[model samples]
Target: MDEIIRAAGALLGQSLRYPVDLGGSSRSTVLRCRTATGGSVIVKAFADDPEARRAYTGETAGLSLGLAGPELLAADIERRLLVMADLGDVPTLADLLLGTDPKAAERGLLEWARGLGRLAACSVQRRAEFAALWQHHGQGLPSWEDEPWQRQNVDAFLDLLTECGLTAPPGLADELTAVGTAGGERYPGFTPGDTCPDNNLITPEGLRLIDFEAAGYQSVFLTAAYCRMPFSSCWCVYQLPADLAQRIEECYQFEVVTQYPDLAEEELWQAGMAQAVVVWTVDTTLRLLRRALPQDGRMHRTRRPVPTRRQVLRHRWTSALQLTGYPAFTSTMRLLLSELAAGWDVPELPGYPAFRAGAGPEAVQTVNSRGPETAGG
Candidate 1:
């Protein structure tokens, strides 16, 4: 540890004080540190992997826009070390949303919208250099939505919705995909793909955006969709008044309509719903995979237990059956969920046991002993 600190000090040309690990991707280590003069900074150091190095550098350059952050104190391209200003006293938008007051959430949401609007409106004319960097550097990384596991992953997400007693319309995933793909191809604007509440910091000066790792030029509709999911979830989970969430959505829509007059309100709202499904689906898949594959390392660290295949199947079956009498092609997401349920409800998928109303321990034994099979091919 001492040797690593010494090496970093040599590169930074300052007397480094302490390093506080801020947990993040497996590919990199993030540390919050303070200098001798009591100035705080964040240092992001990448693993030896070249791809991680490229991504780190790309974000640093691409995100160097109108907003202020910790100054880049030092950077060594070869060592993959970056030291930047740390804005203290400011809390993440997540923190603000967690407050008990609805007004607080609304204020935070408005601040976030204003900040993003300023960024979206900034001149891309001078940003050509960073734009080019993004185009070249971000080519091969995975799209969060297009992962191979997605087709088989709906059951896990459906379990949570069922547990919460919320039954969505059927065939939701395909509808969401169609919506996003269409808007992605047609909409005009910039999008930062991962704009969850954690990425925003509400400072006294204004809303300051952080983390440009996944940002890029995208459709205005897509951009709005990207921002809404996490912001909405923050409000929902934190118990912020429902009205505040509506207001936040309104503020966001206002910005979008102001900048892109051609946007249709109905289509934008549909796109937002699609975006929400995408986020929820991915989250649910990981939850299920952890349960079915308990030996997998990622599952061990999470806070919640993975849902058994039987439990998920049961939840999805109940939800899909509820949508049975509804008209065809109603809600896109609902339709997709129904379709997935049809596949998942097959008499037997490799790892899934036969569903019985009263069986618990017996079902676990049956599924685990059955081994892995393509549950829905």
Candidate 2:
């Protein structure tokens, strides 16, 4: 700990004090420290390992771009540490959704979508610059763009289906090749990869994203999927009010359409979104299937109203079933539901706590009694 403090203090040329541990995953240690000038800074020291080094590289490159996020104060490659301006004590989107303020949560969700869409639009042309920066910072590691995780997930899930005694659906092809990735050279834009709810801070300045370890550019539909599928890769999963969810999706689409005008076509945009949704659902299932099927677990350790794993996956499969164009993928999701989720003994996923509360902003926009279909992602 002292070594990390010294490294961060050296990089910033200051005496650091009052360090408070901000929770991080196994990959890194995050600290909030007060500078000699009485302001605070965030110091993140990566673990001494290859995966951590790659994460450090991605975050460093993304922050160095200065497109958005906290200002990168300083960095030291040798120590694998970064010092960034602290955004401070702001409520994250997760906080709002978990709290009892539906209006606030709805507003935060829309703002977050708009911010990410605008960021993607503005950074659409920076792929080369990002690649260069990534290369410079990450000499030996692959960027998220070059990672084979997508294809790996596709294969792994097929194996998982076989293990479950379920065969791949025979819709698009016997080989099931159509159920691959939604990515193409078109509509590529920047994303932080893990745009989960907890990582987004809903500050007074607006929505500020954090944790750029998986940062790279990809199809904008992936980002749109997060809004439409509603935090596609997050543990903080629940249903959004139907109207609010549509508004959130529209807010993102409206911003991105400025950069990629073709997305203004409802059919094209919706189709792309459906493809991305299926891709994300497959990736998520591959990762969580073994763990969830054995037994259900809470999505968050301490958060209330959190759904169980089986519930979340069931919700995702249900949403994927509604997607129009992907017959094979839809069939796969249905089989998973009937064969696996049917015996989980869990009810359908419920709406977000804020939106479901009896009082707070309940039904701000009227809709039929049926709320949003549960999200599986």
Best by TM-score: 2
Candidate 1 — worst ten consecutive residues by lDDT sum?
A: 363-372
Clashing pairs in 2: 315-376, 316-375, 316-376
For every candidate structure, what is the RMSD over all alpha carbons to the true structure, in angstroms?
A: 11.5, 5.4
304-350, model 2: which lDDT tens digit per residue? 55788888889999988897767787888889999988888998888
How well does each candidate superpose onto the true structure, as a TM-score?
0.61, 0.92
Task: Compare the candidates by lDDT and give the number of the best one.
Answer: 2
Q: How high a TM-score does candidate 1 get?
A: 0.61
Cα error of candidate 1 at position 61, Å: 2.4
* lDDT of model 2, residue 147: 78
